[model samples]
Target: MDPLNNMLTILDAEMGAPSRIEKTGSWAVRFDEYQQFRIGAVLRGDIWLRVDGGAPRRLSEGDCYLLGDGKPHVIGSDLTAPASDGDAETAETGGLETARSAAADPAAISSVVLTGSLGLDQATEPLLRSRIPGYVEMKSSSYRSQVARPILELLSRENAWEIPDADLMRLHLSRILLIQLVRTALRTADGCAAAPPDRLLTRMDERIRCALDLIHRQPSKRWTVANLAAAAHMSRSVFAARFRTAVGMPPLEYLEMWRIRSAAAVLQSTDRTVSSVAAQFGYSADSTFSRAFKRVTGRAPKQYRQLAA
Candidate 1:
């Protein structure tokens, strides 16, 4: 199975309530650090989006982007306009207010944006944050031709509050849309022959992906550096270096983390004893597993299960 697909499958992801913003003429809003992933799509007109003081990027209708890095950013129709703090405006309006230019015609809405937060449970957040860049954008023409367009249409309906079961529908649609965005970003990166190696998810090295697949496929297996390297058809030293660079951790560390994380899922879903769960994931002793589990999850297995329950 594809490693990207596997990561999305195992991640405990949730979509926050989506909001729509309609604006006319020049306006800019500065949003403080989100510290979590954010996703947005332009429904109509144009937008200027800049993250952490980076160069401004224009997003036209049908375009969407994901922000994985926790940094302050700005989005507006006019980049030079004095930006008002988004939180302050939201508090004053109880949410993002519909903006219009003074004396502008009521029908002259120049921009409409659909936005929301993508939340990942603590156990799986690091796995993705390490692999994806701070930002990924999917152009209008590119995404509109793929599976994303239909989902975006559904999301637009949610934004309009025109559909039944609005909350439930929005949640599922947002999740699917986020997945499509990542998939498109990955494919776009993969197709770019001139893309650099440092772009992790975009130009993910096939060999490293193979190693990740092996780990996810069999978290219970006693995967050593030597064997994982051999499986990837690389020398042990080279494989270790490459995996660390691409994945942000040494091979064995990733294996242990994955094993513990898998065990945490079982703890919440099943009735197995802690010791049995530990052994099943290659932890020969309960104490050994408990320490590792606490290191990754900040709670003992039993305590974690209790909290989750």
Candidate 2:
């Protein structure tokens, strides 16, 4: 098994998904619902992050911060500090005034803030949660430093106003930053693996990745234990056992999850009927699809589509 090829396949699938972006006053932020890994790039000014009981951490210009779990955290300017019950107007006015004044500063230039929540899906959540710290900061330098600078500029530019394709541009730039962040996070100081040592892949790990790719690339195809084992070049017993150990679930269970995820994409992005999506994913009947979808997502296809829409 080629370890490099397997790693590349995993990364390629992770990077192919779309990321989301929003503009709030002076801040332009991008995030994904997947929430496996969380990242935030601060382009201009400073952001004060208020975690439940911890003191606020200040994120300055050109800084990138990552939060491994999608832990509940609040980020804003200094005005985000603890306030009285009726100090809403005071905080709002203060934040707006500060952001406005900062934008007016010719020296302020432009800054970008990028944040992402990183996780390896539900299967790997426990491993990541136990291994990674609450947050890790990478001081951008050399090539990474150069690459991040422009992303910050773009974010700052978009936050100025509703420019043409501004949101689209921010989303694209955020995606690039995300890829770079993940790459950096995967390689260690000594060039060894940066992902948890215990989580590092073995020979069998490569095969599991291959099997996962097969499921992701063709979720609509009928997949059985025997067929998947053959695809991974392993015997049924060995493949099933090793796959569960490496990927944290039985092969068929992972396939069902991927199928629901695929159907979700269609339901959210396309006008296709639920029955059409059900058939697209090889379900014999819409009821089966709905039951499976509800099992995975906790909402029926129709309700999920409506809420997503």
Residue ranges of candidate 1 with Cα displaced over 4 Å = 14-24, 31-35, 42-46, 50-63, 69-73, 85-177, 187-202, 233-235
The digit string of per-residue lDDT tens for model 2 on 197-306 reads: 22334334677767876776676889999999999899999999988776667888877876776677678888988888898887989889989989987899999888
Expressed as tens digits, the lDDT of each residue in 137-171 for candidate 1 is 87777733345645655655565564557666765
lDDT scores for all predictions?
Answer: 0.73, 0.56
Q: Give the top-scoring candidate (lDDT).
A: 1
TM-score of each: 0.65, 0.50
lDDT of 1 at 137: 82
Off by over 4 Å in 2: 1-61, 67-137, 141-180, 186-204
lDDT of 2 at 87: 21
Model 2 lDDT, residue 128, Cα: 36
